[model samples]
Target: MFWKTILIVFSIFLSILLYRAYVVFTPDKTIFESCLSSTANHSLKFDQNRLRTFQKLLQFQTISYEVNKQNFDEIKKCRNFIKEHYHDLVTNYSEFVDLYDIAEYSLLYSIQGKNLNLKPFLFSAHMDVVPARDLNRWKYPPFDAHTDKDFIYARGTLDDKGNLFAMMEALKEYLHAYGQPSRTFYVALTHNEEAGHSGAMGIAHHLSQQPFGHNGQFEFVLDEGTTILEEVFPTLNNPIAIIGVAEKGYMSIKYRIAMASGHSSMPSAPTAIGILARAVDKLESTLQPSQFGRGPELSLLHGVTPYLKFPLRLVMSNIWLFGPVIEWVLSRKPGTDALQRTSTAVTLISGGEKENILPTSASATVNLFNDFSNELEKSLSTAARKEPLDTTNYLACQCIVTEFIKIIRYTWLSKKDSSLEQSVFFSLNGYSTLNKMIELTVTRDKPVLASER
Candidate 1:
């Protein structure tokens, strides 16, 4: 009787709609997002001191977010603390300058090298971090920078502050002892990378005029990126560190719908909530096809083929033969599947203010990472339902009001070079290992997306 009751309840959605045919074929039923790309070579020395400093840096309440953006006071406090602690390095080791006049938001520190013939190297990290809320859920106060014998937890612990402080401390040590190396060092710490990057905007404007800032040749730019997963892929024994040598393009679209408001007891033909829900579900369900056979992800997969287990390795080695099957398998997990296609994320939805009354209007926001070869306009046109399609297969193949969110250039995970292309993977050894460790075990599954050239 209980089994029957459970079946009856489950039948509501099962009868209404079920997953597409593709998901059923993906076996192993384990999480695939934890998988990554790496070689046996990645190595960075572990240090308890670095972890301690990260905890101290995390203690600073440098919370930055989009809405209710300004937290200038806390930002200044963090900046001042950095200056005070690293006074010797700031005053003697290099040229320390503020990129923004407003509470020292964006910052740049430069250490000139002995040999100008070798190109300079750039290291970048954001000083600001996303706000940590829901205090009750946190193991420790989000800004308290709690540290156990092994783990360090805080607001910016993983998002960025840990990165910023570690670099600064390493820079101070390097400059204090060895002075300068062959490649020049440009350390850039922006004020609010978490919120909108006004600090970065200011720094860019500053770099535009200077001869070395933007014009000078650099060995390679180092930014946040991919990690090394030990064995998420049942096939690999060695950890895989996916270093991004390039990045993807991005765009955002907003949709809104309007309808007559009414009480729950009396419903209308098509309510605002119903219209918006249908449109979003349709937009996502009918997404673009996977591009692993040709995309950058294929390049990384090809590189990792030598490390995969026997049968899987054989399959991965010849993607030309097994491309569709592999896509079907990986595409079930958004984290890996999205890497090969123009990914879409329906982030925000807003509608009714009250439970009893049906709202008159509703809106949804979608963020998309468009493949480099595809145009946003074309992708939009393809995704748009209005231009004659099989109406029976999808949600109302019609849309209402739409808006575009104008965005500044933001850096994310970079692109991996294909077998045919030249790569900058070995350029910055220090950061390569540091980044590997960060994403491998420390940062978990989060990796920032980036643009190459």
Candidate 2:
């Protein structure tokens, strides 16, 4: 009788284990898939021909071309092309196109919905791209539209043009079918996003003065930060869309070390170049804060926790346990780990001029990324105090100052609330949609540090 009772208990336990396994392994439905299907059902067409329009847009050399005067003319042509093709739609939805300006070098178009009473929505994409470094390295001309079975080849195809053109095409189709959207939609195509967003900032400033203020007042904004990839993780079966909620603060610092100039034959204990090199080494060796914060990093951790396996899932589900582990993991890897932490890189170095002369001055430019909690001043102060340098001989100079600017934009996904637990669950649902499409496992990785590249 005792053996029979033991057998019954073992059988029940096995059944429960099998049920748990089944539940864990089952594929979950995501809101994005539902939204996509619903849009498709409503005859929301994603025309290949429209995607071709994006390819055509990419064919132009829209590089900022700072020194080239003709770039302004090219920008005009691109603007004209966009206006000509979408003129009818623009005319029908006159209220949507808020023409901000027609400057000599750039044009600004803001798409506002008919419903003025509703809150405003904005989506920004740059019309300019970075110059192609080497034409010889590319299979096709950087500006030439080339296509493979799965990818489109062009300079700005991935960096941003794809995102901008896709967004424009999507909006055009949506308007063609359903007319103007319910909420106000603003699309600003600036000419100088690559070059400190001079044009974008101008538009942003203009918009700021208007009724639509910055922050949560504008609903949300969306821009290209990362792309969706497929088959990235074992647990995830779909592609994940990485939406950047917030961007890291950027700043540039210059370090100058002075040494007596003399003949090459006579060398001092601390040369300018030598001192600068040591400072560069010191800065690179020391890292900034690795702790995760609000916006995308937090959003990402919450988004992927649901799909994590076993012990990891349990730990990730709880903030107290997951926080330290995520911090530690990000600190170790140079790539994905960079997303969560503030990073620094020495971009430019200058010292001696001639082979025979000892240099009198050496300078190095260091770019840094900081979180919202840390401002540019604080970051600089900390680096100056903490970083090991020859302060006696070295005179630190501030070349470029840092400023915090908040971009007003929103993603298709909703924002998270204060509740840590609920926010994680919501982000997980959003991430699942992206994972399904990209087919990559989204992990609690740091954002790519642009300066590092």
Listed in order, each prediction's TM-score against the native is 0.72, 0.74
Taking the candidates one at a time, how many backbone clashes does each contain?
A: 15, 30
Report the C-alpha lDDT of model 1 over 1-453, residue by residue, as the tens digit. 999999998896443322211232223424346656342433234477666656666777777766247577888877877666777875574353222243255667767677767776767777677767788999988877777877777787666776678678877766655566666666777676655535554544444444554345457667555566777576677677877875665555566555556798887645666656776777678777566766677777766665566567656665656788888988888787777777777888888868989787777777767764555554555655432122343223232112111122222223432211111222221121111100000011112223311
Instruction: Give the lowest summed-lDDT range of ten residues in model 2.
Output: 433-442
Each model's C-alpha lDDT?
0.58, 0.59
lDDT of 2 at 28: 56
Q: Considering every candidate listed, which one attains the maximal lDDT?
A: 2
Candidate 1 lDDT (Cα, 0 to 1)? 0.58
What lDDT is obtained when candidate 2 is compared to the true structure? 0.59
